[model samples]
Target: MSIAKRPNPLFRNLNAKIAALPMIATTLVVFLGCSIWTVIYSFSKSRALPVNEFVGFAQYERLFRTSRWLISLENIVIYGVLSLLISFVIGFILAALIDQKIRFEDTFRTIYLYPFALSFIVTGIVWQWILNPSLGIQETVRSWGFENFTFDLIANRGTVLYALLIAGIWQGTGFVMVLMLAGIRGVDREIWNAARIDGIPVWKTYLFVIVPMMRGVMVTTLVIVAAGIVKLYDLVVAMTQGGPGIASEVPAKYVYDFMFARANVGQALAASTVMLTTVLIILIPWVYLEYGKKKAQR
Candidate 1:
């Protein structure tokens, strides 16, 4: 007969806890603390800087009513949706095709991923030149033979966002492909063999089995691409300068303009709060579902 000894939870993994203290403190102080501060200031009528006087939701009201802010919201939503869908489809397709173990695989992969190494500013500038009416694709095609070639998507206000979309896809698809490829490769060899034994077509197997199994990877890629879309300022600035009359304005640019240019910290914080809410809306559910499932399984 022996007394059962219970382990103290607080002392468990003490070394790991000590190692993580710096990061935890940084996250709490830098990220969480600043977020709360921003939210508090958002409700205040801060003109040049943060102040204590509460203004209710006047900043929010003005933010919503502003035409530029509204346009920015609409643009980001459209860009985010289109970019996510297109990147996912194109990336998965490329990954699947490459997974067939073709020759020159390394070469093709390097070629695809090379663009991803370039910064968004560089990508935007390069694409800006390529889409130029006189010096880019249009000029090259016209020089060859087609005198009526007009491949200038960047110039037209109606199609400028699409131009940005093209540049974004070119820059990001490689990384997405790499992620999807890793996920696809990670599927057990036994699973593939079993699917084959069951006489499942390759496309069917991929569509039904592999895609469903790779949900986690897909979600990760979605969050990355969605975050990029939400913070779409530098690209627009470098390429279009929100040109053709604010045709490609985005929320990030709106925040910057309000904060620095207009000197309206409250309005900027209000806009910032909206962006933060948008991100949290997408993030919270994913985290809940993912971790909840893992914890339940454990």
Candidate 2:
């Protein structure tokens, strides 16, 4: 017996159409709707109760004039840059070390990557405890006949940012290590063999050849780190609560305080809008360049 096979064009098209409908609806309803709502809210005279009365740019004016907002913006830039640079450096070093055909490689890799699995809340608290003046390293060292011991960045206004940077680097370096290691492993082994044959020092080969070859992965790592910086909230909250005064206040925490604690939704929304705009300003060009590269490849 011979069986007849039939191609159903309509069914395939219908399936494709159905598959896309949910995504389209979700984008419109969830993302676009929320964006529009937020924009609308930013213009209102809303306080604890969101009033429908439109107030034009009053909220934005207030937001721009706020010293806290300005400081938060500055802090974000400082934190983002420092965190990205430090994390990248540490991660690269750890990855390179681990890639050297070491024993217990998996164990070491897992140990390094373990921080990425932890919530910032937990990590931040642990770091905070470790950095605390009375209970942590400073006190311990002081007790050990080092009366002049001083690691009080957490309590100092000028150096608290560095303390946060230390915590951020500790938390984020692991992920960077994993990404960089993967990039390193994906590199052609023949290149290493060739370098070995040429008597090129491993360090020189890494610096001159391997590092340059990992540009895509490096960029990926940078973008991820940048996103983390932009959305930096949990760690700041858990560790400092933007404390020792508003010295360490970040934009996200500023927004949160205005939104809920201070009952100023309009200002909060304005701050949030500013953050969104800033992120776009920074990311859009990079994203476009990446997109263009992919398109050219295609």
Top-lDDT candidate index: 1
After superposition, candidate 1 runs with Cα above 4 Å error: 1-21
Off by over 4 Å in 2: 1-12, 16-22, 51-56
Writing each residue's lDDT as its tens digit, candidate 1 over 214-259 gives 9989998888778767888888888998867988889999999889
Tell me the whole-model lDDT of each prediction, alpha carbons only: 0.91, 0.89
User: Worst 10-residue stretch by lDDT in candidate 2?
Assistant: 1-10
Model 2 Cα shift for residue 114 (angstroms): 0.8
**CA lDDT, candidate 2, residue 15:** 74
- Model 1 whole-model lDDT (C-alpha atoms): 0.91
Clashing pairs in 1: none
Tens digits of per-residue lDDT for model 2 on 1-298? 1223554655556778798999989899888898778888899999887789999999999988998998899999988888888888889999999999999999999998898889999888999999999999999999999999999999988989998988888888999999999999899999999999999999898888899999989987787678768889999999999988889999999989988899888889988888888777778978998999999999
* Number of the top TM-score candidate: 1
Error of 1 at 53 (Å): 1.3
